[model samples]
Every structure is written in structure tokens, then in C-alpha cells.
Target: MSDARLANARWPDVKAALESGKPIVAILPCGATEAHGPHLPLGTDVIISESIAAFALPKLEERGIHVLVLPSLAYAPAEYAAGFAGTISISMDAALALVLDIARSLKKQGFAMLALVNSHFDPANVAVLRDASETIVREIGLKVAFPDFTRRKLAEKLTDEFKSGACHAGQFEGSLVLASRPELVDDDARLQLPPNSNSLVAAFAKGAKTFEEAGGPQAYFGTPAGASAEEGVASLDCMSDMIVQAIAAQLEP
Candidate 1:
């Protein structure tokens, strides 16, 4: 295969893949244009989601699944980070519509399934994905596979920091970015930051409306200073497996 990225592939290649007699899967990496603390770049979610797709490509291909990675959906409902600058939060309705439209387009082209590799876990954003996935399967009749890591079964497979529910720009996410896009991380800022133990999950349960209300004044939770590239690579591997397994299950006869 040339490249699994749809943006880089010509139309002829896409057409050929659809005609190939093998299951054709389209991957949409869903992320957000929001703050991720001082050290990590705003596009951290995009980077991680895309990285998961990259890691899963070979595994997916090994199973005779033809894959095409759609250009990442970088904008999402990031209401919690709205207080921070550069955090573009879209409405849940808008996000849902966009995802449905993308799925509709792929369905018309004879795609077997659409796999959503999402790294942004904002509550509203997660809702949008859940709703969109259901709508895609119910209305469009397109097979949709989404590994919602927030669920206990999936969350338990991730890092301890992620399970702590305090992992925003903390060790869990920071480590993923470090492993994939190390150049984007501010080494000085990362090392100078103190640990934040505030659990966003706990705060949300208490009806906290924003990062500030959640006790993340710096828009961070958990221990960022403790993040390591080694842990990041490991996290990606685990996440990639999740994506592959979810898609594989949906493709089952």
C-alpha cells in the first residue's frame, strides 16, 4: 500500500481500494483545538488520535483490512476549556452533524466501516461522538466502531493517571504527545510544573462547569512533570490495540 492517509492518496487509489474485494475501512481521527496545559501543544488530541491510527495501520492491514485515514476532525465541543485562550468549542449539534455527514459520504462510497479514533474526552465532545455513532448505524446503516475509553472497561486498560480521572494535560496525555510529537512539548515548562491532583471526573460529578471550577486553574490535572516518552509509546500501543480490536469486532460476520 502507498500510504493509508486519504488526503495524500489520489482518487484512483481510493476507487481501487473500494473495488478490491476486501473490507475497506475509513478512519477519522477526532480531536480538538483546545488548551492542554502550558507544556503541551493545543493540538495534542489530534496528534494522539492520529498517532493511534498510524500505529494501528499495520495491524489492520495484516488482517486484510484496507484502511484510509481521513483528514483529522480537529474541532470539537470543548466547553470545559472555553475559559482558556485558543480553545475553540463548537456546539454538540454541529459536531454531531459533521460526523454523520462524513459517515454518510463514506457509506455512499461502499465503505465497510468507519472507525473513530478520538483522543478528546471532554464530556460534551464525548456525547457528540456517542450520538453520532448511533445515528450513523441506525439511520445510514453504516458500520461504525468507536472505542470510548472513558468507559470503565477501556479506561482500566490505560495508564493509572488516566484511570485517576485527573488526566487532562497530565502524565497520561502529555506522555502520548511526547512520544509522537516531542518537538511540540515545552521541556522547561513541563519540568517546572507542579503536580495537580484535582480530578476532573470528580469535579464534573460535583457539577463543575469549567476547568477553573474543577480546580485546574492552570487548565491542568494530574502529574505532568512525571510524564515520560517511554510511557507514551506504551500508551499508544494500548490505544492502538483498542482501535484495532473495536474495528475488528464490528467487521465480524
Candidate 2:
């Protein structure tokens, strides 16, 4: 795997790679600049995405998958996290537009495939990524893949305990960051917010109105104290392996 990530590499290098007829896979680390409790960095999504991509790239390259990592899409749809101090969210429309445009650009550049390595678990953002990826695949003739990170399969393989509910800056995410970048996690500042008492499961659940109205006064969902860097590393290793395999399967002749 080349140390030359696309965000740092010159245009000519990217052009040459595209022109070389090699199997190219662009890893777009879709993330958000939002509050992840006091314990975690505001750019938790960005760090997680970058770490996952870094871990996955070499394994992917070994299988002849030329990986180019794009810089993290730092702003995403995070209405739920809006009440938090550091949260910076985009409108759903803007988020979708940005992802779609990036996908279209990658298609035009002649990359063989594009994979969205999303870290933020915002429902609206997930829907947009799914819609945009599908649209690009049909309209622009490019292959796009989005893998859910909070699911049972990933959780079971990555950690010993199964997740309890809809994940936010909870155990799953906090643990991931702890493992990958322990220096960024502040264990003492971790908070364990009460669960949503609303009938709805999350902020985007059917009857959601406002973040406060849906998920209580605070933006967070679960306990962040249980997070450990060891758990985070394990989760990343599991997900990276899964992503690498998915990319390989897609590239199979």
C-alpha cells in the first residue's frame, strides 16, 4: 500500500494511477465533526474512519486492490447531536449532495470502484449514502458499497459483548476511539446519559420532533464510561477485515 493518501497526493499521481489500468478503489471516510461526549474528540468520526481505512488499505492492496483514501468528510447530518457544544451538522440535502458529487467525480475519474467508509451513524446520513451509492451505480456505472458498523455481525466479531440498543457516542464508538487513539479519549469526563423515554428509539424515529423532544435534553444516547481502547482496537480489526474482504469480493474476476 502506498503511503500517498489522495488528500496529500498530487493530481498527477492520481491521474497516473487511473491511467495505469490497475484496479482502483477509493476509500472515502465519511464522518462528522460532532460532540462525542466529553470523553471523546469532536472529530471522533474522522479519526475512526481514517484509522479503519489505514488498517484496511494494506490488506486490500495485497489482493491487487489499489486503495486511495480521501480526506474525511468532516461535516454530516447530525440533528440529534446539535445541542452539544462542538457539534457541526449539515442539512440532509447538503450532506447527500456532497457525497453524490464525490461519487460522481470518482466515477468520472475512471476508478474501478468507490467504497464509503462511514463512521457517523446518523439515520438520515445512512439513508443518503445508500440512496446516492445506488443511484451512482445505476446512472454512472460505478460500484459503491456501504457497510453498517453497528450491526450484530460486526459487533459480535469485534467485541465480546453485543450492543444493547441504538448506538450513539456509546460503548461501541467510544471503545473504538479508545483503542485506536487512546490519547484522544478522556475517561474521567465520560458521561452515562439516561436512555430515551420516548416511544421512538432514536432521534430519527418516526415521530421525532426536536432533539430534546426525542432524545432528552442531552444529545448523547448511552454510557461512555465503559469504553476502552482495547475494545476499540478489536472492533477496528474486525471491521477492517470485513471491509477488506468486501472490497476483494467485489474485485473478484
Candidate 3:
């Protein structure tokens, strides 16, 4: 793997990368430190976001774009999972401040654009991120590329389960963990859970506040038993492509 991660790169390497005279885009992977059912780890979203950014790096390099992958942001508003143990649900305002502060600092650090690769699907989290992105772009003119998967078009590219509404900690999310950190997955328990066909989007539409009320009794939905490493790889490919495309549109336009 190339040393594209900003956290591990030396100051000289980072300075050189930033001054490469290309369209430099810093990758900020956002995830939530929340419970992901009985089988998956609490850092499932973090692992997935980092993995997607890693997968997208070499491709961006090939396109003559300098990439800087910041360490995954692990705190976000996950009010939907607040009732579950191990879920750290930050307030919406706090999340917005964190994102805005990061962007402000990055803008001053010589990077031209900030691409947020977020895998957490909680509405409150996404809302804060989207709002923050808009605010940053408006205030400092720093470009932000946020791939909104909640949209039907983008979600359709991932999988049937994703489009069917049982995405949280289900096959869609589990497959990502399986591909990136298989050792973290409890294969036995994951393979035993039945399919939970709850519609998280619809639940949110009805003003449901928690996953428990959204029909995710075990803090998960979707068909975990059917998750495959192959599916995870495919989904990551789609997600990375979306991020790359968003960046290209911003830089090229």
C-alpha cells in the first residue's frame, strides 16, 4: 500500500504532496462510534470509510491528483442508535462544529478541496455534514465533495439490500467489514441472524427517533447472513468511484 495517509506521512512528504501543482483533494473519512448489532464491531463505519478512502487513493494518483487521507473522524450524531450500548452519539451542533473546524484548518493548510467519505447512514449525521459542507464552501470557497448515498440513484448502485431499506449493520454494512476487517467480524453470529426488512428511511420520514422504533430490535437490519466479501468489494468500488467522480466534477468544471 502507498503512504497516502496524512497521519503517517512526514511533514516533508506532506509539504511536497501539497505543492505538487495538481488538483489536491484531502480525503476526510467520517464514521460514527456506534454499536453495529451483536456481531459487527462498534467501529464498523470507521473501518468502512477508511477502507473506501484507501481503495480510492491509487486511482486518484493515476489521474494525476494528489491525495491526502486524514485519519477517520470517529464521532458523529447517531441519535438513532443512542439507546444501544457502546453508541457515542454526539450532538448535531457539535458534529457541525467539528466538521467546520476541520475544513477551516484544511483550507489554511494549502489543500484545494475536501472530500468527505462518510459511511455512517444516520440522517442527523448526514444533515450536519451536508450543512457544514455547504457552509464551508460558501464561507471560505473551499470545495467539498460529499457523495450522498441516501439518494435513490447512488444507493441503487450498491446493492439490492441497500435499496430495500435494511442497510444498517445488515448485509450492505457487514459485507464491507468482511472485506476490510474479516477478523473483526463474528462470523458465527452474523450467519445466524435472519433478514430484517425494516425501512430506516421511512422510519425517519415518520419522525422515528431510534433504531429500536425503526424495527431494528437487535441494533441491525438487512440480511447479514447473506453478506459476502465480494459484495463488500463491489460496494466499495462503487463508493470510491462516486467520490472520485464528485472530485473530478468539482476540479474539472
Tell me, by TM-score, which candidate is best.
Answer: 1
> Predictions ranked by TM-score, top down?
1, 3, 2
- Name the TM-score of candidate 1: 0.99
Residue 188, model 2, lDDT: 67
**Could you give candidate 3's per-residue lDDT for residues 79-152 as a string of tens digits?**
88989899999999999998899899988988889999999989888899889989999997899999888777
List per-prediction Cα lDDT, in the order shown. Answer: 0.93, 0.74, 0.89
Clash totals for all candidate models: 0, 4, 0
lDDT tens readout by residue for model 2, 1-253: 3564887888888889899989788888888988775567889989988888888977876776788988889998887778888889899889878877888888888988888888787777777787887887888788876676655566456543324444566677888787778787766666444433332254455657545666545554555666677878777887888888778777777
Model 3 misplaced stretches (Cα beyond 4 Å): none
Worst 10 residues of 2 by lDDT: 193-202
Clashing residue pairs in candidate 3 are none
Off by over 4 Å in 1: none
**Best model per lDDT:** 1
Q: Global lDDT for candidate 3?
A: 0.89
Q: Residue 148 deviation, candidate 2, in Å?
A: 2.5
Question: RMSD of each candidate?
Answer: 0.7, 2.8, 1.3
Which whole-number lDDT from 0 to 100 does residue 112 have in model 3? 89
